[model samples]
Target: MQRIFANRARTPEGWLQDVIVSVEDGQIASIQAGQTPQPQDRRVDILLPSLGNLHSHSFQRAMAGMTEVRAAGKDSFWTWRTLMYRFMEHITPEQYEAIAALVFMEMLEAGYASVGEFHYVHHQPGGTRFETMTELSDRVFAAALKTGIGLTHLPVLYTYGGAGEQPLSGGQTRFGNTVDSFAELVTQARAHASRILPGDARVGIAPHSLRATSPRDLAEALMLKDEAPVHIHISEQPKEVADIQTWLGARPVEWLLNNAPVDTSWCLIHATHMTDKETRDMARSGAVAGLCPITEANLGDGPYNGPTFLAEGGAYGVGSDSNVRIALTEELRTLEYSQRLRDLQRNVMIPGEGSVGAAIYLDAARGGAQALGRQAGHISIGNLADLVALDGADTALCAVEGDQLLDALVFAADDNVVTDVWSAGRHMVRNGRHLEREQIVSSYTRAIRSLIDAI
Candidate 1:
């Protein structure tokens, strides 16, 4: 079906007057500008390329607000992690699918057209493997298929509880898998992914983090990169940085840059602490720094050096890492706000020559597509027809034109203005609601109740 999104804004090309986008077989066939809409054409207030969440742990969505209660002492990321571990112990495959379905639904409604799930919840409660190795991953895939969200399934390799080949903590057992085992699991994931969504879904490898995998194991897992994207957690916290130094004699990002072929196929999540050299090197390497600003702030992780990184020509993408809040506007807002707070300046993330909001939004869209290995993030011809339409009539966005619309959408308007979202030309969200929102929310409610009771 061919649809026209008239008077929509296109980045790098100002407001296209009466733009008629033709989508065929889930791909944009052609996009004609300066064309008037016909009677059969569907007109929307505003159209923009949807954003991709480059880093996420779908199951974590269920635990979003559950860890807010303050313990006796100061609550830190480690303390929150303890609660997260306990939460993971009781999740069955059914609960995982339920929680993930709801999470994907929320993501779609939040203007995210695709998600890269950095999945690691692998075995059952204890160290025991399920009958199917890809049980949790299968649930993730099922949820994405049900929600019609583009998925990049990254099966995480979590071998150790901390830096070295440390003994797996009781709560960490389910996530542990040897290098060989992880390779086999990746193969299984690829086969499972091929059965659904074809080229739209990809199976990649995620070496959980520097603390979770050994140097040798990290090296071995990189062998799975045969044309697939590789994502890894790196330097999110000061403690992680200290531990990596103790274990590997180098910081996480520095070590990975020195050791692996860190290229465009790699996305280093949260390189929060880095030397100037590491920042410039990472930017030059063509790898994306997957920034989850809301989650980072919630967890008190240090602010990333956005100004320096961007000045060095680094690429980056945003994600709702913990799904604490799943709005693309919030993510972009928080990302820029964090940079502003850090540098004591305004509009720190945008390049000198472009609009701050447009630059951040477009950089995230492009970097996320590269990170997820998808031909999305743009509304051009031949790209995946994943588009989002904003209610331009909204008071906050009224009179906004060109890059100003993007600015308003990112900083002023909330998710309410995102009236429609289409993934691969399939409308999963309409009138600011996901198609399966009610059903997924009900299932999630039951799952969350059960999990709370179990805990």
Candidate 2:
């Protein structure tokens, strides 16, 4: 058992002063405000419930800055993906573990306690299945264990290169798995996941995208998922949407809404090109919109319809998809900024109403936790103690209090403002750096350098 004191702690209801939190067996044992700190209690200035990244491709961290150059003609997501496919070719299982360690550690430093890794690369080179089908997944789980970061491992079932069950092509060869093969992988993955982190690690199913999984195959994959959360990439690219329409007779979201049971258990990533009705229908379905604003902007995908989506009461969360960058606050900042750039107004995430920071922080935490199928997203008693603390002395938060403090932290403060993080009560990050950062980064640098040299 351990105790921590927060001079100010943000709870779901509101902020509390001089609060004491107790942890036992990696869950919050109790929480009460107006309590004197015990001599053994760890004290913090400001604390908040940490958010989980709803989507990530951890290997893409290795290729963060490699694809920014303009193509000879028509630069877009497909062009960017061609480069991504090429890069994934060089990542061995050993390299995947090394890169994912650094990526997860950085997420801890940036105040994300958990990540929903949208993992897809499941084979050896040239479309050959590995002798052990879940080898890459084992590597990723090892990285999560090495870093003490919570893992929601979404082993993606990517069977085709495009809509209509197209054969695997180019770099995508490594990501293919037949539905029967995928079921075995998921079964082994769940058994493997249970051995680590006990109740905290979740293994969800991802059907890559509309292009990668046909409607019939998607339904079959969902059967393998049981009651676990389901996530899928949908409508991130205009061309992809057009292609799905050509094959499925409807837009990506439209087709899914018509064919699948997309309810609260689903997370539709990058529903970026939805029509007004699609947006409203999606919001009403109680599924989360897994918005990755930084990656979308980086890839030139247009902004999501935030106003219409929210007005229709949608659940949404921000992700570091592609992981080109990994800053929790920066994701929230970019999400709101993208909305502002579209609507040409400030505070686009909220209207003339509540605190934007509180709304973004709370909403994302709730939706992300839901999508990850975890008992997280709060500091209440019996909840997993996934928490983050800010540096009170940071100049960016000078004299800020209550929701305004959240405003400064989310919009003004740099990443260093997050001084400590706990994933399921494990203090993996302290003073704005992961405890194993040096070793993790060293391994990552060596692995990336080897890949770069090969290229």
Candidate 3:
């Protein structure tokens, strides 16, 4: 058991002062406000319910800066994807595990208590089968174990290369699996996760996208989803939207909403190209819009339909998709900044006149937990202890309290303000660093050197 005495803390009821949070068995046992700090209590200035990164490809953290250089002609998501496929060919299981450990550690240090790793890279190079079917999945679990970050392991089903049953090519060969094989893989992944991961960890399913799987296969995959979270890449690029529309009868979001039972359990990643109606319908559907603002801007993916979605009370969360950058405050800042850039207005994320920082931060926390199917997103009793502590004395945050303090966090502060982080009661980060930072960084440096040399 542990007790955290916070000078200020954000609860579902709103911000409270002099709060003491008790944790037992990885859950918040109780929250007592107006309490004095005891000798045994861990002391913090500002505490928040940390958000989960709802979407990530942990292996891609290794290729962050490699794709920034311009190609022969115009650079787009497609061209970048081709390069990503090539780069992924050189990652061995050990290196993959090493990369994931670094990514997870960085996430914890960035104040993200958990991650929904949309893992798709499955096989050995050249589509050769590894002796162990869940080789890469177990490696991801191992990384999670080492980092002590909450894991929502999403084993993706990448059946085809494109819309209308296109053939698998290049590095995609590693991700291809028949529906039956993918189901078996999910079962094995679940067993491995239960065997190796903490109780709060979950295993979910990701059907790569409409372009990568047929409707029949998608339906079958969803049947295997049970009650777990389901994530899909949808309408990230105009070309993707057009291709999916040309192949299917309607646009990607429209088709999914019309055909699938997309409800609260679904997270539609990048729904950036939706029409107003599609956006409103998606909001009404109770599905989360898994927005990765930095990655969207980096890849030239268009802005999301924030106005219509928010007007309809949509659920949404943020992620460091490609991990080109991994700062929690920056992710929230970039999200609001993208809205401002698109509409040429300030304070656009909030519904009326409240603090946009508090609104986005709380909404993203709740929506991210919903998307990952984790019982978190609040500093309340019985919730998982997914929490972060910030240095209120930081120059960027010292002058404020309540919502304005959150505003300072989103608009002015860097992740360096994060002083401590707990994922399911595991205090993996302390004083702005992961507990095993040196070993993780050394392993990543060696793995990245080999990968670069190979490429």
Candidate 4:
């Protein structure tokens, strides 16, 4: 149990001054604003509910700057993927866990209290299942445990190579499994998750994409869905949309909405290219648009219809997808900047209900919590105790109050403005750094060196 008072705290009813938030048993016990600070209260100048990152490939953290060099001909997501496959083909289990630990730590330090890891690198280098099915799953669990980031383990189901049931090609063999094997894999993964994370972690199903499985097997993947949230990569590239239309007679989002039970329990990753109807229909379907702007820009994926989507009442959350760059302010900034560039205007994601910065953060928080199926994204009573305190003296937050503070932080912060973070009542970062940063970096350097040498 703990009590912390903030000079200004972003509560459900807007920012409140001189607020005391109580945490007990890893949940927000109570929030009392307009009160004098107690002698024992941990006090800060500014506090806000931490954001949850809704999509990630933790191992890709290693390949962050390695993919910058261009191939001989035209470069695109497909070409970059070829290099990714080559880079990952030699990663040992030790390297996988090490890289993931580094990534999870970076996320915590960046003010993200939770992550939905879209894990797919299963089996060994030669496409053979480990004697222990939860071997790599254990890596994700161990990384989360070491870092204190809330875990939403989305173990992916990757069966085929492309549309039309294409055979698993080289470098994709390790990610393949039959329906029966995947079920067994998920069952064992859950058993391990229960032991490691208990009720705090989510073990959800990720059907890699429409191209990774046939329509028939998609049903099998959804059968493993249970009550957990469903996340699928869809329509990220124009080529993917065309292939889906050619193969299924409908675009990816259109086909899924028509065929599957996509509701509030689903997150559609990178629905980059969509018609106005698709945007409206997606908003009405209650699915979260898991937008990863930095990764999209890194891969040259086209801008999404952000203005239309939000106007139609869509839910959205940002992610550190490729781990190329992980920063809370940067992700939010990039999201809005991309929209601004597309629309040739500013303040594009601002909601009528809140300030531009507060609106985006709140929406991302709620939508991220929805996608992760976690009791988080709020600094209110009975919600998970995940909070971040900004450096009140930082240039971005020094002179602002209420909504303007967030606006400045989002648009003006030059460095990490977050000073501290607590996930589920455990403080993992303070003074803008994770507690175990040095050790994590040591492990990451060793692991990355080994992988680079192997490559």
Q: Model 4, range 1-455, lDDT digits (tens) per residue?
A: 88988888987888788889999988999998898988998777788998889999998999999899988999999999998998889998899999999999999988898999999999897698887887998988998988989999998889999987899988899899888888988888888898878467899999999999888888988999889989999889999999999999999999999999999999999999888899989999999999999999999998889888888899999898999988888889899999989989988896564678888888898999899998988787899988988887887678887788888988888438887888888789988889999999999999999889999
The TM-score between candidate 2 and the true structure equals 0.98
What TM-score does prediction 4 earn?
Answer: 0.98
Which lDDT value does model 1 have at 306? 87
RMSD of each: 1.2, 1.0, 0.7, 1.2
Write one digit per residue (lDDT tens) for candidate 2, span 1-455: 97889999999778899999999999999999999998999888898999999999999999988898898988999889999999899789999999999999989999999999999999987978778888999999999999998899999999899988898899998998889999999999998888865578889899999899888889899998788889999999888989999998999999999999999989999999999999999999999999999999999999999989889889988899999999888899899999888889988786449889888888898888888887888789989999999988889887788999888877898788988899999988887789998899899989988988988
Clashes of each: 0, 0, 0, 0
* Residue 364 C-alpha lDDT in model 1: 95
Runs in model 2 deviating more than 4 A are none
> Which candidate do you rate higher for lDDT, 2 or 4?
2
In model 4, the runs with Cα more than 4 Å from the true position are 351-354
Candidate 2, residue 26: how far the Cα is off, in Å: 1.5
lDDT of each: 0.89, 0.90, 0.95, 0.89
Query: Candidates 1 and 3: which is better by lDDT?
Result: 3
- List the candidate numbers ranked by lDDT, top first: 3, 2, 4, 1
Per-prediction TM-score:
0.98, 0.98, 0.99, 0.98
Which 10-residue window in model 1 sums to the lowest lDDT? 4-13
Candidate 3 stretches greater than 4 Å from native: none
